[model samples]
Target: MRKIMTNKTSKYILLLICSMSLLSCEKFLDKQPNDMLNLDQVFSIRLETERYLANVYSYIPDPLVCNGVNYTPLSDEADWVFNWPHQQINTGNWSPVNTPYDIWSKYYKGIRAASTFINRVSECKECDELNPGITVQYREEARVLRAFYYFLLIRQYGPVTILPDVPLAIDAPLSEMQLPRNSYDECVDFIVSELDKAQQVLPDKQSNTREYGRTSAGMARALKARVLLYAASPLWNGNTDYADFKNKDGKQLVNQVYDQNKWRKAAEAAKSVIDKMPEGLYKKNGTDGKFDPFLSYQYVFLDRWNTEVIWARPMTGDAVRWERCSAPRQINGYIGLGPSQQLVDEYEMENGMSPFTAASTTANPVINPASGYTETGFSTTATKFTKAGIHNMYVGREPRFYATVGFNGMDWVYKGADGKTIIRVELFSTGKDGYNGSNDHSTTGYTTVKYVHPESDVRNGRHVLKSWIFFRLAEFYLNYAEALNEYDPQNPDIYKYINLIRERGGIPSLPEGLNQDQIRERIRHERRIELALEEHRFWDVKRWKIAEQTDAAPIYGMNVTTGTSFSDQNFYKRKITESRTFQKKHFLWPVPQYEIERNTELVQNPEW
Candidate 1:
């Protein structure tokens, strides 16, 4: 861990203290001088201490934002029409010095802040007197948050330097501050142990609406499950590629021997969450009082504090900006974010059969005759979900497909000039939201509808308020199923959990008697569909050691440049939208070059 020297410690602390004061004017008692006295004053008052904790919570990244931190454009799931820094990664134009989506320093700073709060919050003189056990709960929240930040760091950088629970003093000797990166297993153990400690004191759920986004036992357990799952994956577990990768003292950073027991540990971790937490797969009932899969899937995100969410931040950040980028041009939006053809083909038909028996390099996919999917024509009649003359390829698909993908002719349910009208989106060459050789259009002739609210009128400043879910119950189910299949393939619990997600996704349950390999593919595909655009696919492929096949491949989409009209067959043809480059080194992000320069003990990742 790179330590802040004496000269810079005061500046960093002052900045954080000032930011906390800005969060709420009434909470801060007074402005103080920048010194040790001011630092002590912050922890002396109850409101000031709570405000400092809030500052620690502010570092949680907004995955919904289409910035460097966002992973959707970095993966094959989607593309950004404009030139964002995250796109630099797809073209192999980034490095340690020019790293895009770099959160190494950001999260380390968060970890430091959390440690500081954890160590200092006990000094609050008024907290215990005013509210018994409040300071203890606050300290536990900071502990879980610190563990979570470490989890985020390891997921991207792989085996980062773990700081001690007690933050180093600003005036610590330079030699004492420089630290080498911890081993992968050591880091995982430290994070899990911290989460376990926090979970012992935190509540399973926050009953008060005011504490909505605060850390809970459920969040700690969910994060622990995800961390264990990643540690058990091929990237970290017995990966021989890092055999020679070592620290300054010749300590192997990644383990070099396979451990089947790791998978068992991961399965047990996920099962703990399922058995202990009261969360379930969120559902919404239709007009007939049955489980409406489409609404159930769509509103899981739109609905506030639903049972599905294990952890979520309060409705903060500019969610309206994301809605604007995803909306069609007819509703006065940018329409720059488009789903790829590869993702579109991943959705199953109504009967739960995949549309493609095999993927193709050409415009045509190897269609599965049993699935009844076609690319050559339009629908002649209206179906229950789609309208007449819509592309045949988009029709008769699963409920999640309609809930997620905004096709060329899909209706935009928005308020009209008279306050009510369904505007049809036109993504043909000459249509409203089509690729008109502009930066604001959808390059793939499609837009993402998963996170965009149907009634959000970006033109009129009407935005819906909803939490950006960080962890959910569906993820643990898939995690349990995947881990169980690796260690105990014959376990009936595997199919039971997978079926729960499939049922909510409006698809049929898996056929019995699937072998281990078959079940692996099903679990991966389910994750891709269920957790789409929630910042999971990017890390998932890498952890599974399959990014070379998925991320390195050419990104495909509909032919947005050649179509003449809304119903043109040429527009429905698959075309290469972007080409990506992914090498073995791309699996883990490079340690930032500046960090390497600052700490001689710190080593760079494999090739960077």
Candidate 2:
């Protein structure tokens, strides 16, 4: 839960830049501001140009909204871990006002900045501006940044404008600025065009280590693939959820039938990135000779230079710390988000079959082998369960879960008040430290342990200062598998891409001769499990129009009580909500209600 901001002085300067436009003539569309020197004066300084580029990264999650705290309703779906109050809400109501809105706003702010910078810099008469090589690179960087923002908007809103240039007015009237939403197809074309422009000027990711988190040719290609995949999804292509577009004034923008070939284009884009990217998975610490292709996923998020991350947003200053924020409330803080049983079940068993779908296996029976529960623990357990559903549910599921979630009765280690490393018992049973039952000091029941530093490095702000990964190499592989399976029936390589992920997760490979639909289903399952709680699921559901399939079910949360030990109880068996969905009007967020009122040219999305 870190917030990365541009330096205060630079932000003030940007405010000045925006403010100066106000004092000048209203018709000064391309005019330079008076307080700041002409573009030539600013562009002459090397640091000034770089500083403007750096401002694009200034937008990131506010600490309060990061993984540490779960106020957003989307967290209830899959992209985040939620506990307590969050666990009890109707996740379907995740509206424009949710965390998605905040993320959208910040991304657009960057897009606006980049667009302005690109326009101004291209016109500058300075030597830096005259240098076509660097200028082209800078221009592509701005386009790539703008493409990223468009992708975010499209993924969340379905159909959005592709504003290649900054709007002339900060508060332009809707009538004066009236622009219809582009067709999703047109949006995809615009994004791909921007990426194509970016690839020409962007350096290969391997060219520079210092700028490791910067967007690269690989990032641009990978993102284009992702945009196409969403457009080609069953929800968008075959589903009826996003067949129409509406604006704030109840106006239709553009509409077109979704096509399956978008998947083919998506697959091709993914292939382009895979063939070029120089990054690989970050490995885990292991003892035996078995090479775990899968390492601790936390490494990608917590390790800045982690090879898998293609583009990232680094966290520094006070934002570097995530321990107290992500730790449990019982550890003397707010109770962090808890992983729901929904996600816990999504990860396939070691054998690669959902426990719900698996044929009764004698080794891992539905009933607990021990004398804790009374009925078959699989299907029957959900209805009349006591202790944790199936021991195997916790047993050998995946290594990532252990690294990500702190489970019942695990040792919580940290430097105690004596400045010495102390291991405290976190679950119900008492061993070395007496079990603390209070949520205030310890709902640290399943406190998140992923981002915390090792005991030896337990200084107040000693957490890893890694960049927040926006996209990783593995995701590109998954995107390829997903798109190919959907678009190309003749290709057998689809299974190969998916199996790579399955092999890493310790899940079994797919049975031979499965149809494309079967393979597609498997890929979706893999993505949900592999990318759990990383801000992907909510968009996945929205784009796939499976918000109904994925979101229709009421969210459930484990019912843990204070002072009562759930060691012998199925503490997680509790019904929270009934169902969730986007109302026809809720599909695209109403261009925030205030914005519509402020800018007459700006139309709101259908129903507010």
Backbone clashes under 3 angstroms, per model: 0, 23
Local distance difference test, candidate 2: 0.55
Could you give candidate 1's per-residue lDDT for residues 1-608 as a string of tens digits? 11112332222233223322233222432433224546589899765676677678778877666543678898888887878887788999998999888899999998998899899888986866665566788788889989999998999889989897788888999897889999999999999999999888888876654446778898999999999999999999999999988998999999999999999999999999998755578999999999899999999989978888888865433556688788887778888888888788889998999988855433567888989998878899999789998989999999999888898888888655566668888888888777773568887778888877776677776767676789899999999999999999999999999999999988999999889999999999999899988889998999999999889988888888877777788888778899889999999899999999999999999988
What TM-score does each of the candidates earn?
A: 0.93, 0.77
Against the reference, the lDDT scores of all candidates come to 0.83, 0.55
Task: Locate the minimum summed-lDDT window of 10 residues in model 2.
Answer: 16-25
In the range 455-492, model 2's lDDT, one tens digit per residue, is 42333434444455567878888998887777786587
lDDT score of residue 264 within candidate 1: 96
Candidate 2 TM-score, true structure as reference: 0.77
